[model samples]
Target: MSAPPPADSPRLDLLRFLERVQLQDLQRTRDWIAAEEKHAVLEAARRPAPPPPEWLIEYGIGTGRPAARVHAGSCWDTRRR
Candidate 1:
């Protein structure tokens, strides 16, 4: 078996390397979020607002003839079954 690394050896270098890799990954994630936000803003600005429905202006409540009502004890009632 090999002897353990000294205090000032490459053993501590692994920590530094890991830190650098993590920092690079964090920067990449931040850049991706910024790009996605910019894309969303551009897409929202390019989209047009939908026109209002025509029925809203012409149709009124109680303007048509009353509809026939079904009997309460009809076969359509599942609760009784």
Candidate 2:
């Protein structure tokens, strides 16, 4: 084994090594996340999204109305008094 650096000497070799590893890991993680997003987008694109139901938009009333006046431009999930 080689002798350790003198106390006076700066220990930059470890820092450089760590920086390299950190950069590599960051890039790998970024690539992985990008791949996951692309896969999700592709899967979503492959499957046709169901069209919005006629009443789901026109009346916004499907489920039991908690309020008398259901707001327009909102889904049946949203209710307003």
Candidate 3:
């Protein structure tokens, strides 16, 4: 019987070409993702942190009484105490 044709057929060549094109597209997507991640990190780093919250010093009901308690400016119990 006759042997089969060689492996280097036109179909195989077309498949190889398609594979290369897909791989290039995948690599480009990955590169875009990496660049966006880097940009996010830089933007976060450049942003300034918020200032510290205000502090409230509650004093005892006396002429020279010490501080009753220390609370933040936005504490709910500050008005009650």
Candidate 4:
């Protein structure tokens, strides 16, 4: 096997420079990600909620059973399975 390069070698210096450049790029990417997340949160807050469904189907107590009752969306007496 060949001996390793010295600590002060030009190749090592170039690698260190590349590492610093990549680190700066990584930090910039993280900043961009944070900004995008903040923008998405703000957009979601500004957006209005969707309207409730016009119809509701109440299922039976057991699995694979047919719907027990079909009521209007505004019905308040709906029971949980």
Candidate 5:
């Protein structure tokens, strides 16, 4: 076997190298997260808010038994089986 590195020569070089690699990995991950956040913000700004529910606009004013109740009754009846 080859002689081991001298104890006085900072035998912890491997540990230091590993730590540097891990630090680089962490930095890359952080950069990716930042980029993703930026993309999400841009997408949100580009997309329009969804329009209000049709029922809300159509039934806003007084109407014969709100459409909801009518639909609910029919759904309940069908589920009785």
Candidate 6:
């Protein structure tokens, strides 16, 4: 009887090495892209500074304390003491 074909034949596995090399290269490129995205995000975060105290998003969006200025003996009327 004729022997079956060999599984390790060059024609059958010709692309194995090339596929492995391509996969490694693809993984390296993916890692580089991820690192680049992280670096870009960090750079963007650092470039912008916090808003100033006077920088209001909305002038009358929420309730604010009364405009009455502080006066002497005013704390006695308050229940916190």
| Best model per TM-score | 4
Model 1, position 9: C-alpha lDDT score:
75
C-alpha lDDT (0 to 100) for residue 77 of candidate 6: 34
lDDT of 6 by residue, 1-81 (tens): 988658997865877788988999999999999999999999999897855343222223237844333324423332221
Model 6, residue 66: C-alpha shift (Å): 37
User: For model 5, how does the per-residue alpha-carbon lDDT over 19-73 read when each residue is reduced to its tens digit?
Assistant: 9999999999999999999999999999999864333212323556343322332
For each candidate in turn, the TM-score is 0.53, 0.55, 0.56, 0.81, 0.55, 0.50
On TM-score, the stronger of 3 and 6 is 3
lDDT of 4 by residue, 1-81 (tens): 989999999999999999999999999999999999999999999999988778789888777978888888788866564
The best candidate in terms of lDDT: 4
- Whole-model lDDT values for every prediction: 0.66, 0.69, 0.88, 0.90, 0.65, 0.65
RMSD values for the candidates in order, in angstroms, are 13.6, 8.1, 11.9, 2.0, 11.4, 10.7
Superposition TM-score, candidate 2 onto the true structure:
0.55
lDDT (Cα, 0-100) at 24 in candidate 5: 100
Residue 12 lDDT in model 5? Answer: 70
Q: How close is candidate 6 to the true structure, as a TM-score?
A: 0.50
Question: Candidate 1: deviation at residue 47, Å?
Answer: 0.3
Clashing pairs in 5: none
Model 3 agreement with the true structure over 1-81: per-residue lDDT tens digits: 977656898987898899999999999999999999999999999999977569878889878979999998778777754
**Candidate 5 — which residues are off by over 4 angstroms?**
1-11, 56-81
Model 6 lDDT on a 0 to 1 scale? 0.65
User: Each model's number of backbone clashes?
Assistant: 0, 0, 0, 0, 0, 0
- Looking at model 6, report the run of 10 residues with the lowest lDDT sum: 53-62
Give the per-residue lDDT digits (tens) of candidate 1, residues 8-76.
778678977899999999999999999999999999999998764332222323658343343333234
Clash pairs, candidate 6, are none
lDDT-wise, the better of 1 and 3 is 3
